[model samples]
Target chain A: MQRYFIDTAMTAAPGTTVTLTGEIAHHIVRVMRMAPKDKVELVFPHQQAYVAELTQTTPTVAARLIAQLSFNSELPVAVTIACGLSKKDKADWIVQKGTELGAQAFVFFASTYAIAKWDPKKQVKKLERLQKIARDAARQSHRLVVPEVRYQKNVTALCQLPKDQGVVAYEEAAKAGETAQLVQVTQQLKPGQRVIGVFGPEGGFAPQEVTQLNAAGFTTVGLGPRILRAETAPMYYLSALSTILELQTPVVQSAYSE
Target chain B: MQRYFIDTAMTAAPGTTVTLTGEIAHHIVRVMRMAPKDKVELVFPHQQAYVAELTQTTPTVAARLIAQLSFNSELPVAVTIACGLSKKDKADWIVQKGTELGAQAFVFFASTYAIAKWDPKKQVKKLERLQKIARDAARQSHRLVVPEVRYQKNVTALCQLPKDQGVVAYEEAAKAGETAQLVQVTQQLKPGQRVIGVFGPEGGFAPQEVTQLNAAGFTTVGLGPRILRAETAPMYYLSALSTILELQTPVVQSAYSE
Candidate 1:
């Protein structure tokens, strides 16, 4: 069954019919050629999923909520990826993959070395396109909610975003073999805490920009020793978070002590 | 300074000169527009990096080897990524990002659900192009050597590849919350041992294909809860390995026990 993220938070009790409209209706009817009796999964605004059975297919599409599904695909700690605006394709790639990897939101800002300049005239259109990519990716990945995408004019504006914890993926930290800060921050993270990680553009962050990030409470951390590309670093950081938070088993010291 | 991977096992002893030919020569002379006395790094077949100064830029580029630099960027354990052949661009993305993340080799085999079929005539050309992508990525990431790229006709050939340990990134394992195998395998990995990981294509591995991998000594391992795209899974696995082997500090259980 195909999955779609619905915008309105309507009750999906077992007997209620939900009508699909706008682009989603067209997608189901024309692109997918879905007919009455076909099945689809609709994700509600509050991040709950329910199976739906199509009841009507002409002119518009409608489905009845069959059952509610359980399982939170979202990460325990919400992560917002803040990147210095990169090339167009790189930005799109980050949004798509970041959503699949369980990012809560994505924020892009213009850094000192950002090669791709954001046009003030086209900002809304560009942001909308990126948001669409996130929605589609979230659907494909079976994520409960679509990650919010936003753009900022510069790093100063980016620093204002609220997060319980902030970290920066700095290449110099990798060079200096500074690995403890990430571990410290991630270990201190509790479920539902918001972490915002900022990465530099292809040219990386300038010294003054790093200072600003430091002043704003973002600790610089290394991904690893290898020189990851500007685009690759964020993925590395996100994966690290998942490994530490989700995958690793807790250390039971008694066994080791013996 | 720029870095170039040289094929021949040439000595880069101090005061000795090495000549660049073919594509690498053109890249230095034409693309990079190098002048005499400019510095460049040369990586030989032995995986040693040397700082060299341009001695000649005409006919064929020549450089004088100044000193041998001694830092190995290769992972403690070698990793080979075996993926079911996916769409053309996805396969390329895997190779490029996998190289940057420290994959020692890449093997693409056709799974039962693989949508892309490799043409016998174009295999060599395609493999070469992917190999070039890995080489460029290796140089950019300051890796010691380029990862080897290979094509296999089916999963059977992939099973025949020798490895110390084999693991599959099975989606079902994630659903079952099977998190121990990857940690177990990576923990027991000794330095220089080879580990091969197999990932499915867009449609994923069929039951019979999974059985085939199991028979070949591959242990299925889950990445995490959220779904990962075919290209993204291998990078996640590699990053996990790096986090375990390179990034994390060993737990001091004795101190905690007290």
Candidate 2:
């Protein structure tokens, strides 16, 4: 079944029908060519996924909620990857793969060493495309929620976001063989807490930027011994957190029961 | 300093000169526009990095090995990523990023659900491009060894590769909430042991393919709750393995002591 993230809250209870209008309706009628009686997974604002059948597809697409699905595919800890604005394709790659890896949000900020400069006039279109990629990736990955994607004008703006813990992926830390910083931080995080990890551009964060981040209470952590590229570092952080919380802890026991 | 992988065994001892010829020599002379006294890191067959100064850049490039560096960036366990053939760009992405993440080798095999078919006639050119990507990525990441890239005709050929342990990243295992299989397999691997991880194509493995892999002694493992794409799955596996064997185990204490 095809999946779409409905913008509205869950208004249709089981056995009730709801109308999906605007862009989503056009996507179903035009792109997907879906018709009446076709099935789709409709994820609502509450992150609840419901199997819905297309009741009508003419003027507007409508579907009746059949059953509520019971699965939590979100990570135990919500991860926000705050990366310095990289080149065009690299940012797109980060958004797509980060969503698939269960990231909750993505924040792109301009650091001193940022090579790609975003145009304010085209920012809307750029953000829309990135958000669409996140939605598609979330749907492809069967994620309960589509990660929120946004842009920060500078690192100063990024430092203002509210987060439980903030950390920077510093290559210097890796060079210093600082292995325990990330492990120690992730170990102390309880379920439902939020963590924001910052990464640099290809030229890397400047000394003043690092000082500002450290002053803003961001702990520096190393991914490993090898130097990961700008886009690869965020995915590495998400994977490590997943290994620590999801694999090591074993969230659900059904598979292990055997 | 710029880095280049010299294609011969380490011939010169410390404080000795080595001749660089062929493509590497061409790259150094023409592409890099290097002159005498330029510094470069020379990675040899022994997988050791040596700081070498350019002694000659005329007809052939020659450099004097100044000192033998003492850093080992290779993964504790050698991982070979055997993936089902994907689209051209995705396969390229996997090889580039996987090299940076410390994969020993890459094997692309045709699977039951493979969307991309490899032509035997073009195999040489394709393999050369991928190998070049791995080499460039290895140099950029300052790695000792450039991962070897190869192609396999089918899944049976992939199964015949000698490996201490084999695992498959199965989406079904993730759906069943199988979280501990990969962790268990990675935990039991001693240092320097070879592990091969198989991944599926866009449509994933067929039921018979799964059975075949299981019968061939490949343990099916889940990469957490959310789904990963064909290219993303292998990087996730590599990242998790690095986190386990590198960060958690504390491979080198020199960088940590400061």
Per-candidate interface DockQ score: 0.45, 0.45
Interface root-mean-square deviation of model 2 in angstroms is 7.9
lDDT of 2 by residue, A1-258 (tens): 678888876575789898988878988899899999999988988788999999999877899999998888898888999999899999999999999999999998888899999999988899999999999999998998899999998888878899888999999889888888886777777788889999998889998888888888899998999989999999999999889778853233222122
Residue pairs in steric clash, candidate 1?
none
* CA displacement after TM-score superposition, residue A30 of candidate 2 (Å): 2.9
Q: After superposition, how far is residue B157 of candidate 1 from its true place, in Å?
A: 1.2
Q: Model 1 chain B: which ten-residue window has the lowest total lDDT? A: B249-258
lDDT of 1: 0.87
Across all candidates, the chain A TM-score values are 0.95, 0.92
Per-residue C-alpha lDDT of model 1 across residues A187-257, encoded as one tens digit per residue:
77878889999999999999899999999999999887789998899898888788767775535322211
For model 2 the TM-score comes to: 0.94
- Each prediction's RMSD over C-alphas, in Å, is 2.7, 4.4
Instruction: Indicate which candidate wins on lDDT.
Output: 2
Candidate 2 regions with alpha-carbon error over 4 angstroms: A249-258, B249-258
Which portions of model 1 miss their true places by more than 4 Å?
Answer: A250-258, B250-258
